[model samples]
Target: MIIGIDLGTTNSLVAVWRDGRAEMIPNALGHHLTPSVVGLDDNGDVLVGLAARERLITHPHLTAAVFKRYMGSDRVTRLGRRDFRPEELSALVLKSLKLDAERYLGEPVEEAVITVPAYFSDAQRKATKIAGQLAGLRVERLVNEPTAAALAYGLHQSEPESRFLVFDLGGGTFDISILELFEGVMEVRASAGDNFLGGEDFTEALIDGFIDAVGRPRGLSDKAATPALYQALRKQAEQAKRALSSNQEAEMQVLHDGQTLSWQINDAAFQRLTEPLLKRLREPIERALRDARLKAIDLDQIVLAGGATRKPLVRKLVAKLFGRMPAMNINPDEVVAMGAAVMAGLKSRDESLNEVVMTDVCPYTLGVEVSEQIAPNRFQAGFFLPIIERNSVVPISREQTVNTIQDRQQALHVRVFQGESRQVKDNIFLGELTIPVPPKPAGEISVTIRFTYDVNGLLEAEMTVEDTGEKHRLVIEENPGVLTPEEIEQRLRELARLKIHPREHLPNATLLARADRLYQQTLGEERQWISSETARFQAVLETQDEERISAARQALKQLLDEVEGESWL
Candidate 1:
């Protein structure tokens, strides 16, 4: 069966089209939200999800979380004894989710539709697909995360038409998209976002506040000294931030360098600390609305997605800016996965979702750098000439004409870039094409560059030299920061040797890791209580009595849940 996966920055989830409905497949721990964390055990086995997340506090040197921030970079995380690329780390998470889906479906799944932020670069998108390949699944399509959320929300409505905005704030990225549904077609009018802004930034704001108040602890100032201590403070800050989301005031304490550091923050204080980030949330919304050529009042609905939307200030900001209360009918954490499943079903031509026809726009402006001549013997380079503007409908072709500046120029170089910047240096260079031209006087030799951008995010350029009628075509696929075909094959061979933990051990391992993390976070009686509970759970695990182990694990999970409280997601 084909599945849809939301390979998110904070958490990952898998869903499938089963029995004419989109059904979320629970992980081995019976939880739909799997933390996007990976680590290696002492025995040299890979650990993912909650088990690995716990290690962020207990074994920071050997665990990596939030690696999604480096998807297109060459940065590597050293976990345990091995060094791994960001994509490699992501592959492990995808592989773990794949195993969960296989066990849930009782079959070997082969393909999936994965979702990425609408503003992800081409290199980032390709890296994600390569990650899927590394995990033994064919990546069929990469749906925009905000668009996916809209699809899930719009598919159920019988209304003939409507225009809605999707404000998606996830762990590490934010996206704002505008979509119009008319006559069974859902067309994305525009998308804009700051890839680096999201829920994590809010937590970091709190961290900054604590650091400013307590003075930078020596261990935290130098992460290499005590990585675990730094990670613990980060974790505590996150929890306290979530508490402030519901409670007017929240208290957090971190033990660092043999000293207890404590801080108390009310909702107003947290909001003030995160005001800069909250301010950034409006630009994307305003841009999306402007790009769609509509005002906030023109929108029929404003949909919220991603776990970060659960923040009270975020909702308040949306209401204040948009002059309306944002829609929250669907669970923010689960909606994207549900929409991805529906997209997967649509890709497979599932009958239930046949009526929905969705179209997405190019997220960035695609253009080429040109030299403009305003006077004789005077020229200016770095001028951007846009062939297709950002937010234009995909599967589109546009042509722009250029004249040779020098007399009898032998060739013209077509340099391609993607961005809205007027200067070529400010945009991302995709590739270039050199078209041979018949030497002619200045302004006599002209070449037309036709850019055909497809729905699959591929850009094809055709340069036609007007003098000789010679045409050169190039399919722009080579990009910096992405592995070549040979590199991908070699990397695949290297990754095959990596051994992830067996599925059967995941539940117990996750519970044990969480309890250990709690034990480390507490002090005095609470610490002793957690210590005894962890030991008891360990003893029960040794018995290997399936029924008894299951009962104890559930009880332990409940106790921890009560103590930690419900997560914002």
Candidate 2:
């Protein structure tokens, strides 16, 4: 059976369409949301989700989270003895979700429809597909997150025609999509977003506020706190941020080097701290509306998706901007997964969704680098000529003709790029190919370059000589950030060999990791007490007595709760 997966930055979820409705599938932990965290246990077994998240503070060196922000980049995150690219880290999360789906469905699931940010670059989208492949699942489609949300929302709309906007702010990315539904057709008018802006940035802003209010530890740079302390501060800041969503004020306290640093932020203060990020959110929304050629008043509704949208500050900003409260009947966190499941059902030709049709737009301009003649003989290089404009409907094919720039030029070099920049150097180079042409005077030989962008957002470029009709296709396989087929196969084999920590031991392991982290964060007496309790729990675990282990586990948990409260977990 085909499943839909939301491989999100902060969390991931799996869902399946059942009985004509999308139903969320609970993970091994009996939770619909799984933290997008991966780490290694003491035995070198892989730990994912909650257990791994708990290990962030305890085993910062062995754990990786928020790797989604680096999806299309060559940056490597080292977890334990192994170094992993962002895609590999994401693949581990997808693998965990795949297992959860299989277990929940009681069948082997081989195919899936995954959701990605609409504004994700070409390489980022390719990385997402590769991640799905690495998880042993064939990716049938890569639906844009906001488009998926529109699909889910469109299904329930009573009106035959309506226009709405989807504002998605997740852990590490934000997207804005303006969509219109008419006569069972859901069309995405435009999509815009910041790949680096999201809730995590707000958490960072709060961290900065804390640092400014309460001085940092001695010998530490302004931005260079130790990982453990940073993790601790992050946890507290995240919880406090969430608290500030409802309450007027929230407090964050972290223990560092036997000293307790505390900061309290009221709603107004939190807003002041995150003013810049809030402003960043507006630009994308304005751009989306402008691209759609619609004013705010024309929108029938504004829908909020993604976990970060739960913030009162964000909601307030949306209301102030649109002069209306956004529609959020569905849970913001599960909406995209639900929409993905709907897409999966559509892919499977489910009878219930036969009448619904959805279409998306290319989020960025796809173009080729070129040189333009300035004088009779003078030419300036590094100009960008767009083949397909941003927000153009897909699956689309557009061509742009260009002449050779030099006399006796053996080949016309075509470099494909994606961005809004006017210069080639500022744009993201997707790939390049050299097309041979007969020797001729400058501007005499012309070539027609056709770019085809599919519904899944993959781009293909083909160049044809105007006179000879010779054609060459640009194969985007050499990008260093993307894994080659052979590399993918090798990585697959390696991932297959890595063991996942047993599900039954996760509670104990999580508790132990939490205790260890708390031990490291506490001072004098508290540290010694945590060490003792942790030892007792470890000894009980070693005994392999279920009754004793359960008793000791509960006792240790209660002790930790008394000392640190439940917010940290």
Candidate 3:
């Protein structure tokens, strides 16, 4: 059976095509969403989902989440002794979801339809699929998260053909998508976003305000707080933001190092703290609408997705900008998951979803990294593969031909890039793929780089080198950070072979640890939260039957819903 997964930054969700309809398969928590956190133990093995998040307090260095932002970059995170690319870190989370689904269905599930942000770059989309593959699942297709939601909503509502916008303020990324429904196809006209901004940013803004107003323990930098405490504060800050939606004010108190720091923020103040970030929301929304040549009230319907959209500020922003209140009924958090399930149903050829067809776009521009000698001592940077824009239709391939610069250059290299950066160095280099160019006049050798975005948003670069019949294909991916291959290999071997904390006995570890324990003890409200949390944990543990593990997990997770809530009391 085909399943749908929305691999969000702050949270992840899984849904499946089942019993003549698309059904959302909640985690052990009975809730549809699961935090995407992963905790590393003494061994290289990983703990995913709620347990991983729980471990965040006791294990910050070993726990890493929000890696979706680094999807297409060359950064590598070193945990303990091992080196992990952003995708590898993400694979742990994906692997967990696969295990859960298999356990619940009592079958080995293979194919899946994964969803990405409509504004994700080509490389980022490919990385998502790679993560899925690494997690041992076959990626059947890559659908945009917003478009998936549209499919779910549009198919169910059967609204007349018109234009609309999908405002997705997810956990780690924000995507403003303009889509048009015509005939039977829902086409994404344009997409824009800041991949680095999302729900987490709101927490950060709140934290900064808390620090400034209430102040931290003497001599403790906001950075020096323990992993657990920092995690707690961020978690509370998010809760406060949510609380402010209905309540006029939310208060927070934490006693660190015998110092009582207390503060209260009203909805107005909370909005002020996040106002700077809110300013950013307008551009993407407007840009998307303009790209589609439509106004805020143009056609019909404005849908919202992602947990971040739950913020009252976000709703006000959309309502004010669009001159219309967005649609309700769908939970901002679960809608994307629902959409994912619907898309999976479509892929499975489920009759109920046959009317739902989505047309998404390329999120960014694709080009080749090129360097030309402009001066005796300086080189100028440029790129090829122009004309094609990001957020363009996927599963689409294009052939672009170019020639070599130097004569008798038998070995020519093809450097791929994504983004609108004028300088090649500013863009991401997927990898250096070489072609066997025949030794001919400088400009005579010709080669073509075929850029393909499959239905799954996976990219393939096929080089046709005419000179020596040398054809090679390369996948654009993160180069392990600043480490050499030898260093990375040695690091991975050591981390995998021996048990160690992700902090690796570094100075940062001691500082972070000291701050962590301090913060947890001071979080007084956690006492009130203990009973329910314990109950939830115990319920899941009771399902010890191997075949019942999936069911048990779901039970455990039901308690974790509203994870952002402060239990400190």
Candidate 4:
């Protein structure tokens, strides 16, 4: 059976086609949304969703989430004994989701239709598909997140055409998509985003406020060693952050090292502290509106997604700026997953469901590294190559060719970039290619690069430097994930050979591997959190006594439920 998975940054959800409709599948936790966190024990076993997120506060050093923004980079974050690429880390989450769907359905589910941001680059999309492969699920299509949301919202109709501005504010990224829905084709007009902006900054602002009340916010250097005190402080700060949303003032009390201290803050005060962060959020919306050549009034409706959108301030700011109440028919939380299920139904061509054709946009610009002679500054640009125009219907392919400049050079260097910068250095360098060319004079040889973006936004690329059939005989295997075929095979074998256990221990063991280098400098309480939460989950495993994972999971849920921007952070 085909299902749609909204592999989100802060939280993830799954849904499937059944009984002539799409429905969300709950996890073991009895909730529709699961945190996109994974924790590891000392024995090298993994814990996904709730259990993993529990280790965040305590085992901050050993947990890493939201690596999605680094989708197409050379960044490598190390946790324990292993160094994982962003795609590999993402695979762990996807793999866990696959396991959950199978367990809930009591059947072996193999294929899926995943969703992505409409503005994702070819390399970023390729990386997502590769991650899916590593997770052991055959990704049938990679639909755009906004488009998927539209499908779930049913913007397609036989009536008058309408334009939509999809404002997606998820955990790690924020996107603004303008689409024109006409007939069955929902054409994307433009897309824009700020990868680093999301819900996390709000949390940080709250944390800073707590520190400010204590008179040392920038850093702890000014204080005389507040170790356990800081831990209790962070907890209270988090609580107060949540309280301020629903109340005029929030009071938090904590006892650490035999001292009881109280921190009090008002909602207006908290918003003021976070005003700078919130101000930046408007820039993306304005830019998106301008890019679509429309003012706020031109839009028929604005759709919202991502965990960050739940914040009251986010809602207020958007309403004030756009002068329109946002649509909330679908749960702001589960709409993406619902859309995924609907798309899967359409892709499968299930007879029970009606015809549902879809279309989406390219996430980023496809360009090459070029040398302009005006001072010999190297610039990456798409001024020439714009294959597969932005916001085109998916399952589409396009090609662009570049010429070699030097003779006797059998190899042509292909450097690809993703961004809107006029300078190549300003854009993201996905990777480079070295294509072998037949011996020829300078400017007489051309290399064609083919880029294909499918319905799910999965990317497949091909390059040929010869038209004479000499170098066109290379292999055409398309592996998009960060892990190569060999790496995926190796991981599968390792998992199969090991006696995987849910056995738990102290907090340290429960933190995910990539968190070590990330939050190492955290204080004792935070340091001990990983171990504490690990025990919380381990204790739940029937065979493991003195190991508990339940406490951590419950605590994580409690903490996250009250968490304003935890998912986006």
Highest TM-score: give the candidate number: 2
Mark the regions of model 1 whose C-alpha exceeds 4 Å error after superposition: 216-225, 436-440, 468-470, 523-533, 555-569
Specify the poorest-scoring 10-residue window by lDDT in model 1.
215-224
Which stretches of candidate 4 lie above 4 Å from their native place?
42-44, 72-84, 157-159, 213-239, 251-262, 373-389, 392-401, 404-411, 436-450, 458-481, 497-569
| True lDDT of residue 546, candidate 3 | 46
The lDDT values for all models are: 0.86, 0.88, 0.70, 0.66
Candidate 2 C-alpha lDDT tens digits along 294-382: 99999999999999999998999999999999998999999999999999999999999888888899999999998888898899999
Model 3 spans > 4 angstroms off = 40-46, 72-89, 155-157, 216-218, 371-379, 383-387, 406-411, 439-442, 464-569
Model 1 clash number = 1
lDDT value for model 4: 0.66
lDDT of 1 by residue, 470-536 (tens): 8899876566766777888888998898887888998888878888888887778877887787788
Model 2 whole-model lDDT (C-alpha atoms) = 0.88
> Which residue window of length 10 is worst by lDDT in model 4?
472-481
Distance from true location, Cα of 282 in model 2, Å: 0.7
**Residue 282 of model 2, lDDT score:** 94
How much does each candidate deviate from the true structure in C-alpha RMSD? 2.4, 1.9, 6.9, 6.5
lDDT of 3 by residue, 1-569 (tens): 77888998988888787876556775544456667876665455555665456556667777777788887566776665555777777767776677667767888889888888876776677677767766667886888888877766754345657888888998888888888877887888888888888988998998888888777445445744676567767766866777887899998765566676678999889888899999998888877776777777685878888888877889999888878888867777777777787887877788866666677777677778665678764555565455356657765788787777776878777777777677777775555776776788876887877788666655677888766566788765443232333544554454345432332121222222323333354345544454444454445547655445445434433433343222221
lDDT of 4 at 549: 47
Error at 183, model 1, angstroms: 1.9
